[model samples]
Target: MTPSPESVTTMLYQHDDNGALLRTDLPFPRRSGKVRDVYDLGDNLLIVSTDRISAFDFILPSGIPDKGRILTQTSAFWFDHLDVRHHLLSTEVPEALSAQFDTEPLVGRVMVTEKASVIPFECVVRGYLEGSGLIEYQQTGEICGNRLPPGLKQCDRLPEAIFTPATKAEEGDHDENVSIGRMIADLGSDLALGLRKRSLDIYRKACQYAESRGILIADTKFEFGKVGDEVVLIDEVLTPDSSRFWAADDYQPGQAQPSFDKQFVREWLSTCGWDKKSDPPALPPEIIQRTKAKYEEAKKRLTQSEPTL
Candidate 1:
């Protein structure tokens, strides 16, 4: 029988800044998120991840030692392989910040990128049945306006993956689902369809590659930004934290499947019995260890490169 993904441990937050929003040592950054610290240094963007861990939206009090390295390194692997036009600066950094931070330590996770006007939406591509797509299908009979085959189960593969665009919410807000009409109304029809198509092509290609590596890419998020005349893929791609990774050997359709990403964290939260509306709990050592291992294993298994975790 498949087990439920829930968590019992709590994620307590001692610090609000996870080295993303406001940095003291390096030049101040324009933005920070649960895991990434970003700087707009004119010619490039500098991203750094602190050791902070978060679950269910709460940043934990304890920080993992090498979590940042793992995140940075994996992104490097993706940026290298994607070959899509992107905004990138090496953490080799520019001559500017090279004085203090060593480039080698930030591999995979840290990216020096050309800053662009981030598109207002997140490009979510789902090649399988799961998560929001599944929930949406069960309720509305459609996913982001695309109808799905009836009787699809929790982890079933879709007839074909589809692109579902969502408005980007502020850091703590949830992104509401929008229809193709809604997206086209906001972004002209030409741009909306263009974004959707590009999203599908990238997702399909990445899904095939992940399958080859013995990992299943369920669904993943991507961000795009415009640089002058080009639209580029921004942000991280397919990290465990960003995407769902199912062990290929054990994947099944009718019920929830084992996920290499967030399975331990989710399980602990459920066992702890915290209300989803309440603040999240702190992660115990075992949970943290397992979570870290899952992230690293997913990155390595998919990319065939270690992510310094």
Candidate 2:
């Protein structure tokens, strides 16, 4: 059975006094993404998942407590469950860098991974019609340049999962969906075809597992990178931040479904009366608690484990 949110302990990193860690000043060279900070360590990279959350292109002022650890743990679970080759080397902080900060906060929130030449695409697969796909389909009867059968409504399950790849955007920009032909033009047919097949296979395997756990994977995005000559999975996999996870018991075909992802945060942001052009306001305490519950619930349900009380 799934565990209650309160069962998990709130252990904050000493440096994370604000409940959200906005940045890390590690001694090594690093680059920051939406939610992760990647540090270069020659052959390997250290990725630190922060409690920081972003919505509608703005990183909100407030952060959810324990959000980083939950995301890291969820990704680690998938990396272990899937049989495919991936970039994770160890979740352990290298002994070499132990003096950088309080290692306690880093535990369960950092990964030491093999560095690769990352592919520049968001390999997305959709099992249900929703999100940008729904918007595109409503307008063009197509998504990612592929036409589907007529009359599909929002959140309707597609006859089959579809591979719709998008180009990865720079920080603070939106990712733009591109056609297979465009992918071939940019990445060549052989590589594009390989990514498509690998993405669909992984999605199917994950979907089956999630369904058994009472979660529906509506859609998800994946990142890949080249280690030497082979393309291997890189970055986080199948976590709530990268996937749309709906509760199987509450799923409805014609309306937006309740989710175990940041949809809750996004929904609240959409209706909060803030203009998209200005800085996003800090999330209210209620929103933060509710959002954190969803992430924790997703992790517990998928792993089929009780919280570490």
Candidate 3:
């Protein structure tokens, strides 16, 4: 189940006492996305991942019940797990700010990151045949640059994970997948190579480990920023926001399988008659609850524990 766009928006304002999402009379710096409310705090960016859910690029009416928290906490988990000390600077986040602003307002979904100019690329890594990859395969017989084995069905795993890079666009703009060469042309060749190499490494490592844990990392997106010659991962990693996660136990590949992601929201939109261009339809309460649970389940499955409320 997924939420109606209206209902989802309605659900976001409510938060538990654990922390409150901080709002200000002074508006946040205005880089808007489908779900995140971003604030620029000097050298740090206060990122509040909201419960809002999007399907087909349209923000659905119903929010994924408690999705914001799951995304926030899940991102934190990955930040800590990777432990590379690159973009995340939660510790440096003002405790005073944390105390004054309602953290539970945003739940554990808020992050204070060292502000770096975001790389203009969406570092995509694919380890299976599905979604965009499947479409590309059926239409062109190639995904990114790799050819697939014959008889592969939807949701089928690939022989190996591959790095698929694309350009990150502004709100309402679609991210375009370009070859490494184009990436080099836009962002110097050296940087492009680094992004490609690192994107693949992260995906390879994360997917391999996730497989060991009974989760299939079908695909995931990564963002990077440079902190003096060091290429560090940025933005959200492995969440339903940026990745497609599948249950390892239920592995069947002929058609779309149940996923701990936005499957419901996507399905509902297909029947809504709303073109993917305009605002999407609101999800029913049942869909909202299911979508919310899907988020929590993904976080739980990945972290092996309940997220901090």
Query: What are the per-model C-alpha RMSD values against the true structure?
Result: 8.7, 6.4, 6.1
Give all TM-scores, in the order shown.
0.86, 0.93, 0.86
**Model 3, range 1-309, lDDT digits (tens) per residue?**
876755543453543232223222213564557777777877678877766666666665556645767887788878787645458777334565545443335546677887776788888888888888889889877777777777788988888887778888777677887677778889998888878877777777787777777788888989888767677787777788789888899989888877888777777778868777866666677676677778778888788997445
* Runs in model 2 lying further than 4 Å from the true structure: 1-18
Candidate 3 stretches with Cα past 4 Å from truth are 1-28, 83-85, 91-93, 98-103, 273-278, 307-309
After best superposition, candidate 3 residue 295: deviation in angstroms? 0.9
Q: lDDT, candidate 2, residue 100?
A: 39
Q: Candidate 1, which ten residues in sequence have the lowest lDDT sum?
A: 5-14
lDDT-better candidate, 2 vs 3: 2
Q: Answer with 2 or 3, whichever has the higher TM-score.
A: 2
- Whole-model Cα lDDT of every candidate shown, in order: 0.73, 0.87, 0.73
User: Model 1: how far is 261 from its true place, Å?
Assistant: 1.4
**lDDT string, candidate 2, 110-140, tens digits:** 9899889999999999999999999999999
Please list the residue runs of candidate 1 whose C-alpha ends up more than 4 Å from where it truly belongs after superposition.
1-25, 100-108, 276-279, 307-309
